[model samples]
Every structure is written in structure tokens, then in C-alpha cells.
Target: MSLNGKVAIVTGSGQGLGFAYTRELARQGAAVVINDVNADTAAQAVAQIEADGGRATAVVVPVGTTDAAKALVAGAVDTFGRLDILVTNAGILRDKSLLKMTDEDFDLVINVHLRGTFTCVREAYAYFKEHNVRGRIITIGSPTGQRGNFGQTNYAAAKAGIVGMVRTWALEMKRAGVTVNSVIPVAATAMTKTVPYFQKAVEADERGEAMPAFFRHDLGFGTADDVSGLVAYLASDEAASITGQAIGAGGDRLQVWTHPEAATTEYREGGWSYEALQENAGTLFTAETLQSYGEEFLPLPEDLKPAQAAEAR
Candidate 1:
């Protein structure tokens, strides 16, 4: 899908997935605004896009503030004449177990990933309403949010909150012909390098070494470019009907995640007593009836048993 004459503002576009999204949208004929906290990286990204014959400008500002977010949208309109798309891809990692996680760590991640997305979308939605444009808002999510990860309470909570915002905004903006969606990516990037196994696999791939058989099934699927293609499609007009959805992109795999719903319900003619609930709770909340939210990707060696894995941690 072509995005000619469209103007897109991608936050944290100086590097990683945000950069990939900005470049892809620009390459597809959109004027992109590169927003990042680092001025040099933002300028470098703009320069690279311009060198490739794409139109782009840089906005070096932190995304977590209301003022900064408004400035970002204003910059886009001032530079490109209109705002059409917003990609909230700025985030930070502050992984720690629940007991060990500090308030500052939790607040920082939420500020960047969840609140930052909210501020940007809020500003962009105002602009879209003022101009009567059918804008597209794409927020970034993470697998850790869908399936909880160890030592990542802050990051997982922030990512999950982002998805919640997307769903709510999608419903609110539908009448205005604007669309909102979330993209959960599982690509190998600098952010994923924090995990020791992922770092080793990336380093090995860079050295032209083959990954072990255990990791062969999933390692080195694709980079940020692979994720950007899905984001670009969602930004295009063809995906106008596709809102309030969470999409996953990695390597060649694209998936539509199921929305939360009631699997089953228990009711009575009158309010049940504590004794009744205590007796029936066993059957109502059985392990077999509950959905699992554990991590699916086990990067551990196959020879490691459950007990050994626990011990290793």
C-alpha cells in the first residue's frame, strides 16, 4: 500500500524498530518526522532517509511529556502540512522481579511506554479531529506482556497497558474514521540483547556461525524491517477497517491475537454465600479450565530438566 502525501510521526525513531518504521513509511512515499531524545541520532536518521530520496525531518524531544508530545505533532504539521499517522515505539526496559522492582523503575517504564503513547495519541487525535483526517495510530507491544516473563514486571505491565490504550482509543476513534492498533514484535534487536541467550545468538549470527539445534527453530527470524512492514500496512488506507486489534510480527509469521472474553460464567437465582463460593470455587477455577499465560519460548538447553532450570535461575 502506498502512503503518498501522508505525514507520519514515529517516536523513538532514531534507532531500532522505530527507525525501521520511519524509513519504511518514508520509502512508501510518506513525509516522516523522526522523534527521539537524542539529537544526533535523530539527525542521523533524517540524513539517512534524505540520502535514500525520502522526505524526513528530525524532532529531538522526549516523548513522555504532554508538552513534548504536542510539540511533536505540531512539528509534523508545521513541516509536512498535515498529520496522518502516529507510531508510538519509544520504550525502555527496567526488568526486575516483583519484590525487587523499585518504584522509580516501574514509573520510568510506564512513563515511556504507556504514558508516552497516551500523550502522543491524545495530541494526534486532537489534530485529526480538527482537520477531519482519518488518522492511524499504531502502538508497540511485547510478548512479555501477553505471556509474563521472569524479572520483567515493569516492562510487561507497561506493554500490556499500551494494548489496553489501543483498544480503548480504537473504539473512541472509530466514529471519526480514525484507526488504532497495537503491534507486538518478536524480532532480534538491540533491546532484546539484554537477554544473555539472545545476545549470544545475535553475536554468533554476526560471526557467521550456525545456531545450535535447540535454538534453530526460532533464533534469527528477522530484524526490525520485518516488523515495520506490518506497521506500514496498518497505516495505509486499505487497513481502515482493522482497528481495536493486536497483531504479532516476527520473521515470516504474522498473527492476530484473540481478545479477552468470558470462557464460562456461573450464576444463581440469588446472591451466593461465601460458603457456596468456597465449595464451588474448586470447580470454577480449576487449572484445566483456566488459560495459561506462561512463556512459550524456552531458550534453555533441552537437556535441562525443570528442576535444573529452576536451580539455574
Candidate 2:
């Protein structure tokens, strides 16, 4: 009950990963504000939390606008009297390759994931600063954001942008003693159910079977609930010094992702001309010396290979 007497707001928390986040916060003794577009699911989430002997309320609204963000903070204070933690978890996926992705597709994803997080965090931080509350702000990110993904151009951009914002906000909020961090979660939820490996894991879970070790251990994919503990940890008093970090969590693993940094730097007096650069290009920059481009998709064992991928391989 480290979070006892605290109030929290988790957006897009009707179900899936967002729901798990709300439940965990409530379990930690925070009175929670569950925000979702679907009234039914939002109500259901509140009911579930209440049944678990935790206090909660629902705010049913789409979460990308300033109005909705304002309403959520208002809802938290009106319902629970204050806001101490905000999990900007609302997001949507528009999975299309660059060539096939439309402007509408890109904008829609950005509107929800990036703009929604921005508005919500902006409002929540204002409340924290005004009240002198040492608040915790946890923003959601994705593997696709940390590294390039094949067909998630919009998703990657939005999620990566979220982490970028977290780093900046952490610096800005440090004086107020508020912490801001990104949670890069890899879990089997509605958004990931379509992935072959996650599909297999979901099927296994539905059948009351554990996910294969390859997924949990190596791939870092697990049930949504498995990722909730990290969210809860970040929301607790113990995480006060853990700002500006991108922490990854899943089945059996937790990771600290390094902030972006220059891989290699070399000084050139007067900045070498094209002819000088050409002479040094091979020694300084080579295919073998560059960093990796995308997330590692380890080779799945024969029995664990996803069906669609099995056929192709």
C-alpha cells in the first residue's frame, strides 16, 4: 500500500494493458480514475476495481484533445480530491508500411498516442506543480518505437516521440520533485494479438497453458498483467529517483534502456571537405562498425515458430 491516499489517472484503461495498469495502481492503494472511450468497458473496469476493494471512477471520453485531458484531471480531483500519478496509456495502431500508409492513418495514430499523451501529461503536471505534489508520470512506449518495425510507421513514430517527451519532462519537472519516465512494455494485448508469436501465446493463455519460454525469456513477450508490476513500481514512492528512464518489462525480465547517445564522434578541424571525407570515410564509417537498426527477433525453435513465418521460412 505504498500508494495509499494517492490518486491516479490511467487513460485507455477500459481493458487490456491499460486495464492491467489501473488494476495494479488500485491494488497499490491509489484511488484511480479510469479513462476510456467505451463507457461499458470503463464502467466494467471501475466495477472490477471496486470488487477488489479499491476505489475507482470512470471517465468515458476520447483522450487526444485538450478538453478531454482537462476533463480527466478535473474528474480525478472531483472524484478523489487530488491527482498524484498519471499513466498516459491511451493509444491506437495504424499498421501500414511507409509506401502504403496514408496521411490520415499517420495523423490518427499521432493524434491518439503522441498528442493524447502530451495533453494528458501537460494537464497532470500542471496539477502537480500547482499543488506541490511529487507526482509520477508514466508514459507508454513500444518496441517498435525503440527500434524500427516493419509495418508500424505511425505507431513507432508516436511511441518514440512519447519517450522523447518523457526525457524532456523529467528534466523540467525535476525541480518540483516529480518524476517522469517511459514504460516500454512488450505484452500480449489486443494491439499485439495479431503478431504470430503473440497470437500463439494468446491461444496458449486462453487454453490455460503457459506461454513458451522463448516468448517469455528471449522475446520478452508475455500477458498484459505481467507488465503491470513495472507500472506499479514506477508509480510508487520508491521510484522517486528513477526519472528520465525508459524501463522495459515483460514476462520474466526488466531492463533499463540507455538514453540516445552518439555512438562515435570525431573532431575535424575546419570540417573536412568532400575530398578529405572520402579518404577517411572507409576507416571511420563501415557497414561492420555501425550499430544495429531494429529490434532483435531471435530465431524461434522449430516447434515454436509461428505458422505464417514457418511457412515463409
Candidate 3:
């Protein structure tokens, strides 16, 4: 009952990680608003919660539209009488490499992940402020946001933007006792299942397609429940002091860190003179470079299966 009597809204809760979060929060005595673009899934989620002796209501909020997001906030507050927790978890993936990515692909992801989150959080904050209620805002991010991934430029960028928004909002909302944070999760959900590469990985495991020796030691694919545990914590009263932080939870692991480390100043008072910068350019490009260079690139895993590898094996 960590979140007892709290009212929460979880976007995209019809299935996957979002549904798990909604169910668990309600179980902990929080009344939850379950939102999904799919009407049936949202209704089913609410039904399951009610059957378990928990309180919940489901509403459909299509991804990427401001009107849908505003309506969702209104519905949650209208049903529950107030809002305490907001989980901005709704998103979609238009997988493609940057070269192959269309403007539409990029915009679609941004609209859902970035703009959609903004709409929900913005309206939720207004309600919180007007009611003089403290609030918790948790956004769903990804490892790709921390480390760039091939074929996920749009997703990565949108997630990275969430981190930025969290940090800025944390500062702005501090006086109002509103906490903002992000969670980076990896789970075996519909989103992952739909990814051909991930699906292949799961199938390969089932078929003994080069099962690694580490499989015995390593925790297997995470379920939605696993990620929901962290979500439950962040939504609780105990977590009020924690804000502007990211918790990476997946594969039964949790990691917390303050990102965009501060750097030593080599930025001298002068326009970019090639010679002056060259002297301390190395220092300038330390771990904390410009915000534009938000994330660092990592090489792909040696065991990663390429398209050709799938064909060959």
C-alpha cells in the first residue's frame, strides 16, 4: 500500500509495460486511469483491475494527438477527483535507419513520444498546481536514448528528449513539490515482440539457435511486472525526495545515475580562434560536451545477428 489512496494515470496501459504498471499501482491501493489507443485493451485492463478488488478506469487516448492527451487528463481527473501520478508511457516505433527514415517517420515518433508526453504532463501540471497537490511525473525512456542504436534514430532521439525534459521540469517544479523522472526499461512486451530483430532473438533462444553459455548465469528477458516494480516505487510517497533522476530497470537489474556530467572549463573568453581552441580543444571535448552531443556512440555487440546472418543461419 505504498501508493495507497493515490490517483494515477498510465498512458498506453492497454498492454505491455504500461498495463503492468497500471495494475500494480491499483493493487497498491492507488486508483488508476488506464489509457490506450485501443478501446478494447483499455477496457480489459480496467476490468482486470476491478476483478482484483482494485479501482481503475480505462480511456482511449490515441498516440501523438494533443486533443486526445487533453481529453485523457480530463477523464482521469473527472473519474478520480484528482491526479497524483502521471506515467507518460505511450509510444510507437517507425523503425528505419537515418538514411532510410522519412520525415513522416521522424515526426510520428516525436509526436507520440515527445509531443504526446508534453501534452499530458502540461495538462497534469496545471491540475496539480490549481489543486495545490504535489505530483509525480514518470516518463518511459530507452537504452537507445543513452546509447544510440542503428535503425532507431527516431526512437532514440525522442527518448533522449524525454531525459532533457525531465531535468528541466525537475528544476521548475521543485518549489511545487512535483517530482519528474524517467525510467529506461527493457521488457518482453508487444513493442519488443513486434521488432523483427528482437523476435528473432527470442525464437533463436527457444530453438537453441546459438544459446550462449552465459544464459544460465544471466537473468532472462524481463516481463512487464519487473519494470512495474520500479514504476510503483517512483509513484510512492517514499520517493518524493527523488527527482530529476533516471532509473534503468530491466533483466532484474536497477541502475540510477545523474547524467550529462559537468566538465572542466576550457571555454575561454574569445571567439573561436583556431590556434587558441586547438591548444585546449581536447579538454573542451571531455565527457561533458555540448548538449547537442547528448549521447555517446557504442559499437554493436559482437554477437548481434545481421540480416545476412539470419539468412545464413
Candidate 4:
């Protein structure tokens, strides 16, 4: 999956998973545009990529505004001559339970993760159309969006919205040869380290200690690089056939998430009243047919190590 001569843009590429993606993409021979709100971090990332013999330029754009997004795309074209791939990885965590979450919290997360993705993709689409480029768009998604998480109502909603955008854009751009997809990654990056258990795992890893069993699943509680490989593959030409997908990349596991479907359906000759519906409630709503949220798909580190569970408690 050599990206030689390809020009790519990765938003929030100064640190964490975005940085990993930018580095890997540049390593594959693409001239990368690194966009981050922090000018210093963006310069450092650009310097590091250039130091490693990869071509990269920094663009300090916050990513939610239309002008900023357009400038980012324009900067890539001005610097690299053309654009081919876009990774909408800029995000922030404004976690709070629905009851406690403020309007500000909800709006910030939505603006950065959901609206930011929309603005970037919209600008990129315009550029791709003008240039007749078959662009690859890889949006960042989260498992919290697929399966709701406690105290993350806002974050989950925004992430899920990104996937919806990917689906619609995939259809809209299919005839133009542009592909849109989302990557749901779980890696030990700055974002994941915000969790207590993961913070411990990261600290332990830094000290050269063995991680708990749960953190060692599949390929282990790996670093950002572990997730970057999948993103790179999707950005490459080989993945042109794969669009409108939400792929999971964490540890050594790669998963294809099932799309929404109707699980059950019933028909009535006319509109049923509340009393009529109540008569068939038992058959319509059963315990086995109920859907649940807030269940952890992967075990926590403390769960795998009972002795340390006390600390987590």
C-alpha cells in the first residue's frame, strides 16, 4: 500500500492517534498535511516527520469552522500540489452522564467530533470534485457510539453521528469513485489514558511491567501505532471497494460492525389503541428481545487482576 506521490491531510495530527496516522501515511511516501489547533505541536510533528525522511507540512486549524476546514484543504493543495486522502481524527472528550451533562459540554463535543468531521469532509469533497480526484475519507469513530457508555452521552452521540455521515457520503460519492469509511479504534493514546485503569496500564508499560490479562487481549493494550495500520490500509487504493464501513482496530483484533436492521416486525389491520397494544405486550416486548447498553465488551485491567481490583474500587 505505497502512497507514493499521494497527498493526504490528517486533522489533529500533532498528537495521539492522529499523529500516528500522519506518520504512517508519510512513511508510505505521501506528502502529509498535519492539522492541529496547537501550532507548536503541529510544528514538532512536521519536524519529526521530516527528520525521519518523510514529507509533511503543518496547518494550524481548529477544524470545526467552514473557513478553517477550507483553509486546511487549500493548504494541502498549495503545499503538496494535490489532495488524495483525508483522515478526520480531531476530537475532544466532554464526558458526563445525561443528567449531569451541560449544554456546553454537549455542544463542544458535538462541534469538534461530529461537526468538525462534517466540515472537513465537505471541504475535501469539494476539492476532490474540482480536481476529479478519487479521494479516500477515513473518519474516526468510537465503540462508545456503537455501544453506549456511562458518563459519555455527548461523546457517544457525536461519534455515532460521524458514522452516519460516512454512510451517507459513501453513497453520494460512490459514482465519483470517492470512498468514505469510519475506523473505531481502541488504543493506549492520550485519549484512552484519561481512564484510570488505562492510565495505570500505560504507566506500567512505561516501567516495563507486564500488563494485566485484560489489557493483553488480542494484540495487547497496544499503542496508537497498532491502530494506524488499519487506517493506512483503508486510505490506500486497495480498499476502494470497502466503503460505508465501521471497522474496529485495537490490539490484534479487526472487527466489522453490523449495520442497523429491523429485528422484529408486526402488522395490524388498523391503528391499535393503547388497550389493544397492552393485550399483546407480552409477545411484543420480551426480556430476551430487549437491547442493553453500558455493557463493557472488553474486560477491564482490574477485572483480570483481582488483587488490583481493590485499587480500582
Per-model lDDT? 0.86, 0.91, 0.81, 0.86
Encode model 4's per-residue lDDT on 58-177: one tens digit a residue: 899887999989899989989989999999999988777789999999999999899999999999999999889999999999988999888998998998899988899999999999
Residues 218-273 of candidate 2 have per-residue lDDT tens digits of 87888888888999989999999899999999888889999888878878888989
State the lDDT of candidate 3 residue by residue for 261-311, as single tens digits: 664544567666989878877878766574553333233344644465567
Q: What's the residue-level lDDT of 70 in candidate 4?
A: 88
Q: Which has the better TM-score: candidate 2, or candidate 3?
A: 2
Candidate 4 TM-score to native? 0.92
All candidates: TM-score = 0.90, 0.96, 0.82, 0.92
**Which pairs of residues collide in model 4?**
219-252
Give candidate 3's error at residue 186 in angstroms.
1.7
Clashes of each: 0, 0, 0, 1
Hey, what RMSD does candidate 3 come out at? 4.4
lDDT of 1 by residue, 1-313 (tens): 3999999999999998899999999989999999889899999999999999999998888889999899999899899899999999998888788999999999999999889999999999999999999999999998888888888888888888888888888889999999999998876678775555565455655576654444444542456777899999999999999999999887667889888888778897676798888978989888877988756666566442244355687
Best by lDDT: 2
- After TM-score superposition, the amount by which residue 111's alpha carbon in candidate 4 deviates from its true location, in angstroms, is 1.0
Instruction: Estimate the overall C-alpha local distance difference test score of candidate 2.
Output: 0.91
* Candidate number that wins on lDDT, 3 or 4: 4
